[model samples]
Target: MAASMSVTFLDVGQGDATLVSADGHHVLIDGGQARDDAIVPLRRKGIQQLDLVVATHAHADHIGGLISVLEDKPVDTLWYNGDEHTTQTFEAFLDAALDSAARYVEPTRGRTKALGGLEVTALHPGGDTQGGHLHDRNIVVRVSQGACSAVITGDIETDGEHDILRSSIEVDADVLELGHHGSRTSTGQRWLEAVDPDYVVAQYSEGNHYGHPHGEVLERVERAGAEMLGTGAHGTIRMRCSGGEWQARTEAQGPVVAGDREAEAAPGAPAEEPPATEAEVGCIDLNEASPEALEQIVHIGSVRAEAIIDGRPWSSVSELDVIHGLGPARVGDIEEQGEACVR
Candidate 1:
């Protein structure tokens, strides 16, 4: 088995940014809304150069941060879905890629590449994007190392999902980044069943006007018997694959065996001790603490931390309940240990 492959689903507030690293080679899937949204995490992870940078599609939320990355980091190659967009962000991204002097390749379906020990396969937009919805033309990529695999579905919708299913391609993966931020129009029952993922990560903003990761989509993910984690709730979900096994850990949730549908903690795993009370840790101003910092509060795991980050500038601790999974009990626990500092 290779040493380890790490996948980080960055919390980029209403957008998607994922980093995959194996054997010192790195690949960035998408960039969030702001430069720091992707840069800060990259710096924290000590990633100075990217083996490949993939702007799954030409959306601002997905390509905006890549402009900064291209300016700051030395990316060897760039990949896109071949969909054209007239937006300023997409244009700027293209200019940056050109300026960065990286090899630019618009991948097609069935194209595969080996990045160190990881195998990356392009699974979508097999052909032209002329007549289809933009979202349906997303560049879906499957990454695998040893026995663990993860599929990164950009903003693909139901039509794209069905197209992928009909193609002679494999959709099964241990971790599936839910399509279109878990919108009802995507992740259909048949699609989820076909993927049969063990874990699903949905990246969306809390209180998003769009109401992403809709209740219905959540229900479908549950019905698929897959453990779901939302970047809206969990700050950054990290999955590490090693020795033919994988484990997922969030800044708040510590570590859990990845792909375990039973949600069982690995043997000899530390007990699920409650976090430090707000009083002990001092009041965390919901608007000020970084997503990584918010994870320290009692009962505030990655998901809740992300929710708190999303619902920023809280007027009172009472407002915490608005975040999914925070509930009344969890809110009470947080209030006792910390104060919601709102200006």
Candidate 2:
């Protein structure tokens, strides 16, 4: 019999969590908030030991419930983006991970891990990448089994999306979990075009405070002509692939046609404001950003971050060449990344 892979998107309220299993191997990505039930699916499926567990980033909504998973389950390995948060939830998660016997790994772009019939590839957070807003530093991974693939994005916004593309990662997939819970800040037209998924899943609460699955994002998904599924509307989502064919089924219903889930706006209410794209947002302003924020840009670490801060009010991205350790070649890399700006 041919191998089969199953990807389950848990209904973790306004957060992200996914379970992928194939040939007796299981990988859980981004457990939801502390209040959510991220463990129910594991128990329901009789999965006792996880081969791999990934915390895409350190946000409470993304890694909060993972604390319990590490504490209770037998996880062989744990991969995090190395982004840290000061929240109690993050501290607890770190503690649990330290206490567990799982081998810890900080995945960077281009790293791939294989277990059983599945291949997991990290697509974001480049090797020199560090210290930015949590969303920009999100760890995006693409899970593949045979010919089928799914890209799992954890609250990654537009800049992060562009970084993945700029890094030349292959993102085309059969399934895509929408970024930032389908907010306008993510799922840009270019990103949608790059991934070109057959099915897209949005993981957010029905009446979330953030009003996820924004009208613009819905329109983009509709325009791309991909089937749309939501944990809020569909409960839990599961997709299976075997013999190179992929199919999606949700807890409430099967796959939904793209145009069916349009966002409703109040009469005369203005549309949700769109977020700045890579071009529009320009880049991390060298003069304004603190050392920590400057460190988020590729090729710039704590030392360079401080140097740039000390040389305040720079004129252009080209001026970065003057900073110590950043030669013409490194400056070109920063320009190619499109992540740093002077103004």
Candidate 3:
């Protein structure tokens, strides 16, 4: 029987943290900001030691909490990008890494390492990537266990994604940690096509200053036909794979088994088919549709439905951009879905 692999996307609030466990070995990736207490999840999971700890980049949001993790946990190896930063957080992380007993290795493109039952590979930041924007030089890692794999990108923008794509390393995976927290600057159309992940996770805080998980990114992910999960919305999300199959569970939506995403039929919609899951369902009149009907649209949820209702008498689908979080691209998705109409 093949062993099960579990990947937990921690809700670190406006930052990123993920833990991968397989065959009783654990790997920690890119602890969130210093105040996020990213180690708490580790403690909750009863993990006393980590087989490998990775610093995906020098950004504080990605490496700050790692200082504490390195100091407190017993780690066998540390993999980090060689990029240098002057922030106190980066210096503190360096001091902690040096102080720890773990061996340090500077990761390069196409370097693969073994940690228990998982094959961890570096897929970004080649030799030529030196001395560019930090986001462009971010280190990207892919973790594979059997036929199931996941790519965790740490704030890599389009340039970094292009670098990885240009390298042509096999990046197809079951899950993808959306780059740059789902910023429009990352997760380009070409990148999404290459990955073709079943699930794409965006790790950030709700109402964050940068408005992460941008609407354009959301539209693209929808267009790509991949389910999108967000830490800001679902809290901590855990994905498990066994026998070459994957399932996900989230704190907000318990027991989200594979191929069983929530589907609802709007009022007056046909009962035999759900508009949310069907390809050709009747569109709800946005001006006259109830909250429940409005919720059937691609991005409109309960809150957004209420907002749409309160801001009544829409002129066109493009007018949805006036509502918060409903950017032009996302509104376009709703229009493209043909689920919400102004009439």
> Over the full model, what C-alpha lDDT does candidate 1 score relative to the true structure?
0.76
User: How many clashes show up in model 3?
Assistant: 1
Question: Candidate 1 residues 1-343, lDDT tens each?
Answer: 2456677898898898998877557899999978778987675444568988889888899999899999999998899867789998888988888899788898888888797668888988767544456787788999887777899998988888888888869889888998888888888888888888888888887668888888898888777877777776555677766665666765435455655544432212332554333232234467875543454455565678777877776787778788887789867766655434454
Candidate 3 residue lDDT tens string, 50-79: 988988889899999898899889999999
For model 3 the local lDDT of residue 174 reads 89
In model 1, where is the ten-residue run with the lowest total lDDT? 262-271
TM-score of each: 0.75, 0.74, 0.75
Residue 264, candidate 2: C-alpha displacement in angstroms: 16
Reference-based lDDT, each prediction:
0.76, 0.79, 0.79
Q: Comparing 1 and 3 by TM-score, which wins?
A: 3
Q: RMSD in angstroms, candidate 1?
A: 13.2
Colliding pairs, model 1: 233-303, 234-302, 234-303, 278-337, 278-338, 279-337
Q: Provide the global lDDT of candidate 3 against the true structure.
A: 0.79
